[model samples]
Target: MTHSERTSAQSTVDIAALPSVPKVLLHDHLDGGLRPATVLELAGECGYTALPAGTADGLATWFREAADSGSLERYLETFEHTVAVMQTPAGLERVARECAVDLADDGVVYAEVRFAPEQHLDRGLTLDEVVEHVLAGLRSGESQAQASGRRIRVGLLLTAMRHAARSREIAELAVRFRDRGVVGFDIAGAEAGNPPSRHLDAFEYMRDANAHFTIHAGEAFGLPSIHEAIAFCGTDRLGHGVRITDDIDLGPGGEARLGRLANYVRDKRIPLELCPSSNVQTGAVDALENHPFDLLARLRFRVTVNTDNRLMSDTSMSREMARLVETFGYGWPDLERFTINAMKSAFLPFDQRLAIIDDVIKPGYAVVMG
Candidate 1:
C-alpha cells in the first residue's frame, strides 16, 4: 500500500477495539487507581470515615470532581482518603490486587505501578511490611488475571514523596525489594517547592546500586526541572515530562527549533510518560488539544502514553489511547509505536523487555491491525 493508503487504513480502526490491543504502562500510581467500591469497603473495614460520599458512585464522582481542580496540589489532596483507608495489610493488598486486575483487563500487558510506602504507615505498618503486603497483592493479582486469561506482568516502583526527607530511606527500601516484584524507584508529589535535585541522595543510591528510576518532573514545573533530572539526577525516564515543550520553538511553515534541553532529551531517547487526561486535570496543559504529545512524537522523542491515575481521571490505558486518537487522529501504527516505547523503557531486564515487545506487543498489534 502507498503511504496515504496505509494512513487511511490505519485511521479506520474502531476506537472500541482499543481495549483488546496490548499496551504497556510505565507511570501508573497505585494509590490513585483504586476501585470506588473497594475504597468504601476498605474504609468501612478500617474505621476510616472521612470519605466525602457514602455510596460508591457518589465517591467516584467526588474523586473525579476533586481531581479536576486544575491544581497539582489540590489534585493530590484526593489521595488523603485513599491513603487513609490503605493503612492495613488487607487494604494495601486489595488495592494492589485490584490495580493489577484492572490494568490487565484494560489490555496492559506490562506495567510498573508506583506507590509511596511511607504514606501507608498510619496503622503502624513498617516500611518493610508495607512493601511486603503490596508485593504479595500484586503477585496474587497477576495470578488472578492469568486465571481470567488476561496475562499481565506488574512491577512495583517504590516512590518517596518529593516533599519528604526519607528519600534515602525509600531508595534503600526499593533496593531491598528489587529482587522481588519491585522493579524500580521514583519520587512523586507536588513539584513547586520540591525540586528533584532535593532527592539527589536517593538517585545516587539507585545509580550506585545499578537500579533504574524515573523522576516526576516537567509537569507542573518547566524545562529547568527536566534539565536537572537528566543532567543532575540522571533519571532513566521522565514521568510526565510534558513541560519539556517549553524549550521547543514552533516557527512558521511547519519548522520547529529545539533548544538544548529539548534536543538532548530527544537525542537521548528519554521516555516522556505523557498522561494526557491527568495532565489536563492537573493543569499541566489547559486541555488535551493543547498537549504537546503529538509534537514530541512527531519530533521522534521517545514519548509514551500513560494513565497516571485511574480513578481520579476515570481512565485506563485503553481510554488514554482512545483520547489521544480522538484528539490527534493517532492511527494503529502510532499506538503500536507508543506501546513499544513504553516496553523498551520499562525497568525490566533488557532481555525481558525485548521478549514482551516482540512476543506480546508486536503480535497483538499485528492482529489488531489486520
Candidate 2:
C-alpha cells in the first residue's frame, strides 16, 4: 500500500471506509488522470517511445516527482505522453472508459471530467468525433460500474486550451453535445500568460446560449486572473481557486477579513474547486498542511475538494478527503459537506443535482456517518 493509504489507516477516522462514500468531482482533468499502466500501453500502441520509465509504478513515481518540481508549466509536461496516445478514437475511448471505471471504483457517483478536444486532432479526428468517442466510453464504463453495483454518472466539460485560439469553437461544440452528455465548457492551461479574458468570445458565446462554463483561475496566477474569470468572463465556477487565499486577511487570533473579491465570491456562492494535493504539486501551496481549504470552508467560500489530476498528484476523491481529514481533523460530516457542496455546484440541471443529493449523497452519507 502507498504511504497515503497507510496514513489514512492510522488516522483517527477509518480511512478504509472512505471509498464507500459517494463523491462528486468537478475539476478533474481527463488527460491528467490516466493510469500509469494505461499510459505505457497507449504510448506503446502509438509507437511513441519517449516514456521515462519502463514499468508502471516507476512511471507513477516519475510523474509525482516531475510534478513536484516547483513549476506548474513543467508539471503539465507529463500530459504530452497521455495526449500523444489519445489522438486516435480507440485510444480515446479506452482511456475515457477507464477514467469512468476508476472514478466509480473510488465511489464518485457524479463527475464532470474536463478535456481539451483541440488536443486530440492530430489523428484526423474532428473535435466532434473526439467528444463522441469519449462519451461512448463513459457510457460503457458507467454501465460496467452499475453492473458491479456502483452507480456512476459521468459528465463532460469540453475544455479549450487557454493559450490556443479554439475557445469559441470548443464552446460551440460543448453546446452541440450538451444534451448528449457534455455538461459544460471550460478553458484550462497555464494561468500566467494566458488569462481567462483571452477567451472572452467563448465565454460570451456560452453566456448567450445560457450554458455553464468554469474558468481555470486563481491557481498559478493570483486574484487578477480570478477577477477576469468572474468579473469579466463570467465563470460559473473557479477551477482551483486556491490562489484566492491571497485576498484574505487573517488576524493573529484567526479572524478573517474578506476582501471585496472574496466577499463577492462568497456572497455569490460561487464554488471553488480546491485541489489540495494538485495545488501543492503545482506549487499553489507549499504543502497540504498549509492549504487554505479549511479556512475557506470555515469562512463559507463554497469550497469543494477535488483531485485535479489523479495520476500526476497520485490522488483520488477518497484520498483527497483522507488527506483533508488528516490535515484539518475533519470527520464524516465535514466530508459529507464537501460532497454536497460539490453536488450543489455541479453544472447539471437543478432537478438532477437535487435528486443525486437527496437520493444518493445525503442517504449515502447518512449511512456512513451512522
Candidate 3:
C-alpha cells in the first residue's frame, strides 16, 4: 500500500468496534505499577509517609500526573513513593498479587513484571527475601486469576539498578530463582548517564549461566545504547526501545527509511517493548500520534505495546491498545500483531512459548477475528 493509502486506512479504524482480545505484556515494572489502594494500605502498615492522595482513585490520578511531567527524572520520581511501601515481604506479596489479578482483568494472558531489588533493601529486607515475597504473591495472584476463570501466567524479571554495582549479584539471584518464578534478568535505572556497559560483569555472568535477560536501553538514551545492549550485552529483548525511531528517516512524502540499526532490528525481528504513554511521559517521543509504534508496525518490526507502569501511567494493556488504535487508527488485526509480538518475545522456554502461542494466542485471536 502507498503511504497515503496506509495513513487513510489507519485514520478510519474504529475503537469501540474492536472485541476483547487476549494480550501479552513483557515490560511492566512491578514497583511502578502497584494499585493505588495497595500502595496506601502498604504505606499505612509500614508507617511510610503517604503521598498527597489517600483514596485509590485520587492516588492513581496523582501518579499519572506525576509521570506525565515530560521529564524522565520527574517521571522516575513517582516510583519513590511506590518503592517506599514495597520494602517488606508482606508488602511485596500483596502488591504483586494485586498486579496479577489486575492484569488478568485487563485480558493479559501472560506478563513479565520487573523491579530493582536493590531499591527495596532500604527497609532491611534481604534480596532473596524480596524475590521470594514477590514470587509468592505472583503465585497467589495466578491462582486467584485462574479461580476467577481468567487465565494468567506471570514471570518475574529481577532488575539490577544500572547506577549500582550489584548487577552481577542480581544476575546470580535471577538464575537461582529461574525455577522459582523468575524468568529473566534486567538492568534498569536512569539510562542517559549509566549505559549498559556499566553492567558488563552482570551481563557476562548471565550470559555464561545461559540465563535470558533484556536491558532497559534506548528509551532515554539513543541508538548507541540499544546497539550495545544487543551486540555487547546480548539482550533477549529491549525495554522501552522507543528511540529506535531516531535511526529512521522519513521521506518528505512520509515514507520511512531505515538506517543500519533500524534495519538490523527489523531483520532480526528483535522484540521492542514500546510503552506509548510512558514514552510521552519520559519525552522519549513528542506525542502518541507521533509514536513509532505505527511506524514500526508498518515496517514490520517486532513491536509490542505495554504499560510500563499501570498506576504511574494510569494505563492497562487494554487502555494502551485502545489509545494506540485511536491515535493510529489500528484495527483488530493490528492489535493481534502486537499481541503476537509480545508472545514471541516472551522469556519463556521455547516449548512453553510455543504452547502459549498455539493453544492460547491463536485460539483467542481467532475468536476475536470471528
Best by lDDT: 1
Instruction: Tell me how far the alpha carbon of residue 352 in candidate 1 is from the true structure, in angstroms, after superposition.
Output: 0.7
**Model 2, span 1-370: residue lDDT tens:** 7876654544345789899989999999999999999989988888889899999999999998998887899999988878998998889999999999999999999999999999999979998999999999999999989999999999999999999999999999999999999999999889989989888999999999999999999889999999999999999999999988888999999999999999999999999999999998888898889999999989988999899999999999999998998889997777888899999999988999999999999998777654
List the candidates' TM-scores in order: 0.98, 0.96, 0.94
Candidate 2 local accuracy as lDDT?
A: 0.92
* Each prediction's number of clashing residue pairs: 0, 0, 0
Runs off by more than 4 Å, candidate 2: 1-12
How do the residues 237-279 of candidate 1 rate in per-residue lDDT, one tens digit apiece? 9999999989999988878999999999999999999999999
Better of 1 and 2 by TM-score: 1
Top candidate (TM-score)? 1
CA lDDT of every candidate: 0.93, 0.92, 0.88
Residue ranges of candidate 1 with Cα displaced over 4 Å: 1-7
Q: Which ten residues in a row have the lowest lDDT in candidate 3?
A: 10-19
* TM-score, model 1 to reference: 0.98
